[model samples]
Target: MKRCLDEAVLQAYLDGELSGDAALETQAHLAACSQCAAALNAAEGEGAFLAAAFAPDDSVNVPTVQLRARIDAAVARLDAQPETNARPSGGWNFGALLASFTSLLTFTPQRAAGFAGMLSCVVLAALFFSIQKPSPAPNSPAQEEHMAFVTQPPAQPKDGSANVEVKDAPTAPTPEINRSGVPIQVAKFNRPHASKPRVKAAPVASSLAAPVASKAQPLPGEKDYEQAIASLSTAISHGGDAVLKPQVRAQYERNLAVLDKAIEETRLVARRNPKDKDAVDFLMSAYQSKIELLTTVADQAQVAALGR
Candidate 1:
């Protein structure tokens, strides 16, 4: 007997892909060969099972026309309705405000005159109140008495310095004519001598340079500096890239060491003489530089992380 047909030849024969003579030959071979016939039957059974499993159901019907009509009606109603360009209330819409202003501008001149007159009346009322002064209140008896005393002339001295009669000094005699025909008075009185006022001398620069108090006080924002230092230290410890390049780490360490030494020296000087403002300022500046360096390192670390 001939060898069993290839599974491909049998599948092609079942699918009607074989030529007429080849298909007839395959059918004869399958009828004479029980093994080939059983294989073909199994393939046919699998194909039918798959087809049945995936076939479309006849019971689940779709009403395409009705659904299409409903959708069309909804679309037609939407198209018929007018679209409104609504906006949120209380918003500053410049275009709308401008339109309103233009509408107002279209009014007749009489309305404009009325508006102007109303504005003028408001301005006039404001000016009247601003320019007017309150009426003065009547003075009390004591105030009147005080005013009278202040208006009274001062008493003349015994030396007759004023043009009033003095009790101890006699009045001037009638004027006599001099050789040049000018009238001259012949009375004389003793005048009191005025004393000079004593003046205080200005303070010397060396005396003004003396320290007023000795108790040491910290510089302004000292606590803020400490806080920044602590925060940056914590961030350096907990944050930044997991690993930094060796060279970068070395350079940052060197800078930190130099700043640390400088800060230490400044602290010593400030401790020796807490009143030394320059030393305190130097210490504060060193701290600020250290903070800046740490900040730079943190930034570089972030860059490195992002590159990664």
Candidate 2:
């Protein structure tokens, strides 16, 4: 930082590439170095000139009179063509229909009448079928058996209590009889407040589940990367925001979010199939990129502190 700053560095500074303390150092160096200050002014002038040269022209003149005239001419041409009550594309064309009708006149009256009657009958039949909806098929004996509602006959009390009528409860589901005359038992649902004895699950042998557990476990390399990332994150959180400018901190946060999402997605893919080389590669790449980003910020902070 003591040496004269290069034009490239100055350009990066002017372009806002130098963030947090790095930007402060550049500002301090520019203040003390008159030569650099002149160079900065020259850079600013060039930037302004380039921006002005590339600026879009807002004074483009549209030929309203010519456009209006062309539109009006098109409308006049459309109006000159006869519509003859024909549709634009899908419906029958009147001009073609007129030619067909003229050709039809060459046939004798009786032949023409017979042809017209046959065409009318076909058209009527098609219209009738298209307008009507198909009726549902009648249920067979098996379907009737499944769908029939069972109504038990009234029963008297077995205790001979003056013929008390016993009826099926309204809340109970209607049981249906199968084709073999066996009554199908309706599945009864337990009430929400019903207390039931919990059956202890049989102990699963470790050997049976060992392979699945091992498969779910992360690799040694991934574990190391995760530990390193966690440590770096903790260090950055301690004073990173204080050292970073608002804009730089925001940019870093956005980058971290994107990297985190990519890492999570790729990690799932890799976990689903460890043999997938592409997925493993993508996961590792995301981790590496995140590491590089954190490393860059940490180094930049360190360098800026040394300069101070």
Candidate 3:
């Protein structure tokens, strides 16, 4: 029989990873061996010490009432802020904020005062501009021309001769001056045309017809559907080509061709009769079907890569 058990064998025995026979033998050895028993005691004591030292701190745990109060305060602050400023729920980091605040306090009062004065000056200038009545801007070249039309001087007598009888010009398409001093070209709608228009815009049939039942209850999680399709399409377009076997690639191409044909036909129907709700629904369904197929192909490629 061996005089002593190896340290590694004793460790395996403690961990219960040894065979049943080895475990029994180790048990018998520990019974007779004083040094081995002492080593085991020491190992257990070290483990207990480590577990107690590194365990979670109960003091750091926030109370439910305090946490709720903090969350309510955050929500109130977010509501008070402008829409452009973000109000994320899980974005707080108290440690980082404390560090930033400490750094800010390190600045001298004089430096801070200089910045504050500059800000005050800016606010005063803004208030002055807002309250003061702005002087009228000089007339532009276009405005000057428009003013001439409105303020035409009366015909003067040439030395002794009476002023020539000035008749009004023909009422043709000419630019007229508006109150804003901008020249507006008065468009003549009554143009003597030889023939009517060759092609006219199609009238909305749905607008003319009576209202049908509102079948357009919003699609739940429509944003999720769009996001998933976009992510799958991007993944497939980039690295998926490298993972695809030749046979799988050929199959995907054939399926895609079929989907493309269906999409084209449905889109044509939708374009022809935009007022037809059924046609629009068919078109959208076809697009979604195509996106689903693309996602499946990309997922298959991803699984193959993982297996490899």
Judging by lDDT against the true structure, name the best candidate: 2
| Model 1 bad stretches (over 4 Å) | 1-218, 304-308
Would you list the clashing residue pairs of candidate 1? none
* Candidate models: Cα lDDT each: 0.74, 0.75, 0.68
- Candidate 3, residues 189-218, lDDT tens digits: the string is 554545532333333344323222222222
What is the per-residue lDDT of model 1 for residues 1-308, given as tens digits with 9 covering 90 to 100? 89999889978977899998998888899899999999999989988997888677745688999999999999999999876655657788788889999988886899889889999999999999988968889663345445744675544334443343224444556778999999887776656555443333333333323322221344567668778888877777765635678887888889899998877656645644667787778888998999899887777666666677
lDDT for model 1 comes to 0.74
How many Å off is the CA of 85 in candidate 2?
A: 44
lDDT of 2 by residue, 48-154 (tens): 99888866653567799999999999999999999877668767787888988998777898988999999999999999998896888966323443343233223
Listed per model in order, the count of residue pairs whose N, CA or C atoms clash below 3 Å is 0, 0, 0
- Candidates sorted on lDDT, descending: 2, 1, 3
For model 3, the local distance difference test gives 0.68
Worst 10 residues of 1 by lDDT: 206-215
The TM-score ranking, best first, is: 2, 1, 3
